[model samples]
Target: MLTNFRRPRTERMRGGGAYVEQRTNSWAALVGFLLGRGYSAPAIAEALADGTSDATVRKMAQRWGLPAWGRKADGFIVIPMKLRDRATIASRAAQEGLGQEEYCRQFLVAGARERGTFRSVVKEGLDL
Candidate 1:
């Protein structure tokens, strides 16, 4: 499902041991993904690039509710429950006004992102 756009992008990835996940090619790519979940086809079509054809929306619907990373017996995307939980938690944090580092900290307590506090290191700070 498409989380509210106002939410930060920091919640995009969860910690390890998660399963498959679905993603849009870009910020706008999620338009097609959400439309397939019963959003108005016309409205979604007006916004999505991959939505050039109705078939695209149909395919998205056919693939809805599956895991984000793993395919089901029908070959649809299916993310693991662990990953989903982390994503949801982070998403909520973002919605609540947490920044990138805070988002990661809320979901990932001891992962690589935390190991170096790398999640908040945007390229602008590199001083390259």
Candidate 2:
């Protein structure tokens, strides 16, 4: 007599197919929350305390369309002014053969120094 041979079906195989599910990342959500609240990359890493580096935090920020921390000299300030005032600054900068940003920096530094509010270890001819 010939015996019938067949493989046993496991519970998963009996179900027809495996169920696919998306994995959730709580860490990412926490990082997004911190970034949304204006927390810097270094701050986020420190807060997480899971050996996450500031660079990683910055990468996440970049992916989330948030501004990441750039080079040290990239610390910039935004000053809101009227269109007429902006045009005047641009004209003055053009006359002086300087960009608007350079002109603004020079003007601000000069004003700060005159007001005795500018203090730095490296002074005179150094970029502020």
Clashing pairs in 2: none
- Candidate 1's displacement at residue 94, Å, is 29
For candidate 1, lDDT tens digit of each residue in 68-123?
Answer: 32332322222335766667766888798997446656545545545556545545
For residue 115, model 2's alpha carbon misses the true position, in angstroms, by 1.9
Q: Which segments of model 2 are wrong by more than 4 Å? A: 1-57, 61-70, 116-128
What's the TM-score of every candidate structure? 0.24, 0.42
Runs with alpha carbons beyond 4 Å of true place in candidate 1: 1-24, 27-29, 36-38, 49-51, 65-128
Error of 1 at 9 (Å): 15
Candidate 1 local accuracy as lDDT?
Answer: 0.48
Q: For each candidate, what is the lDDT?
A: 0.48, 0.67
- Model 2, position 21, has a per-residue lDDT of 26
Q: Per-residue CA lDDT of candidate 2, range 1-128, in tens?
A: 10221222212322355653221355577777667655667766777665779998888677779765456545555566889889999999999999998999988877677645554544878752
